[model samples]
Target: MKTNTEVVTAAVVGLSGWDALVERYSRLVWSVPRSFRLSHTDAADVYQCTWLSLAEHLHRLRDPEALAAWLVRTATRQSINVLRLRGREVPPDRWEPESTLPTPEDVAIGSDRARRLWAALTTLNERCQRLLRIAAHSPELSYAQVADALGMKVGSVGSTRSRCLAALRVKLEASR
Candidate 1:
């Protein structure tokens, strides 16, 4: 059996790689909505949305090497849109706790905490706030996406996010 890398090279170069396509990327697709800490209702909706986005846009992806990253980006973008449509305020520059598919009560708790945290987040700077929120919301986000979003190298996303989260925590606790 051809491995994922082999298939990717085949796909990227525009050869026969359909079997490997499904095998390598199905899990990546499934993991999209799961990456968000969504409510059950929201998860299902997000899953459907992610698949629809993939269906609509997958063919436009020229770089087969970016298949997984593309799926994740689609899922995240769809999830964000769903949250916004639900009347939540989604900060364009940072992830919001209220963006998840949570019950009102859960949203209330998270929002209250996040409101305080956001205030602190602002103190740290926009970049720190963005990184910390992404880390908090999507533990599964790949370094490539993080790097793209933050304009950093893929390999550095994890360490940069960690430091940002630590700084946010300190600011949050100090505000309490």
Candidate 2:
């Protein structure tokens, strides 16, 4: 497998690595808008827009290795833009219901243990929730990318993650 840096370098030179870039970052990109609780359609738009943004600026990217961070930042901004646009709409009651069907991920995690873990996750503060979600959903992300995405110092990522996991453990233990 090509490293992210290699993929990015290839992309900068030609189109061959574009698919790899998209494949590598798609989940990380999708996770951002989902984290905002945007509707599916809105999330899809954010996802596309994020990729488009990357495509438009690919050659100019200062550090190709920071692609994950760039994607995260772009997706976050797009998600926020979507929320702001939705806020301007006059008819709040016309909102479509979110899908009731279980996503593949939902089915995969459908177990007593997973349910309990999710319940415990919900009890965490917003920062912890966001941090853990990003970390969990994109295990390939570097500490630098995670820190850039979260606007945290890179040095603090490991410590904060440890503390957050400890808190989650406490919550899980309490529930038992």
Candidate 3:
């Protein structure tokens, strides 16, 4: 009496279900790095390591129902470890400041400059804040996708993002 989905779901309750397991949990794995404050490259590394660790823990997963939670927890721990390791590694040549952009001391990570910028973003109206947050999620910001995700008309995305960035900038300068 089981539907195809139910049969597949049953297969996933054991070793024969690993492919299904990977398919189901992949997004959860990806989301860990996506939601985390880590950089994109760092997030990718964390995602990969999370899967590797999951493979090791496969047989030990006491509850198959807990698979999603397990992937997220593993990804988080791996991200923290990677972040700690990065703090000690020498910076890459390409990691140098963008000459066209602001100076490193002026706008480096965790600097007052970045903090003020983020604080200003919080001053935006709720919708604008969410739009900008979604836009900022990936290195390559996709206004169309962001609008879709936020339930906005795609046609309005470009102007909305422009306005949001302008507002953010004004707030930052005002704070300065």
Among these predictions, the greatest TM-score belongs to: 2
* Clashes in predicted model 3: 0
Question: How does each model score on lDDT?
Answer: 0.73, 0.91, 0.76
Model 1 lDDT per residue over 85-162, tens place: 766655576765665668889989888897997788889877877787787788788878888878988888778777
After superposing candidate 1, which stretches have Cα over 4 Å from the reference? 1-23, 88-176
Output the lDDT of residue 137, model 2: 97
TM-score of each: 0.37, 0.51, 0.43
The local lDDT score (0 to 100) that residue 95 gets in candidate 2 is 71
Q: Identify the candidate with maximal lDDT.
A: 2
How many backbone overlaps does candidate 2 show?
0
lDDT by residue (59-115, candidate 3, tens digit) is 555666566677788898887788789889887765766675766665665488778
Indicate the TM-score of model 2: 0.51
Against the true structure, candidate 3 reaches a TM-score of 0.43
Error of 1 at 123 (Å): 58
**Superposed Cα deviation of residue 86, candidate 3 (Å):** 1.3
- Lowest summed lDDT over 10 consecutive residues: which window, candidate 1? 11-20
Q: Model 2 segments beyond 4 Å from truth?
A: 92-176
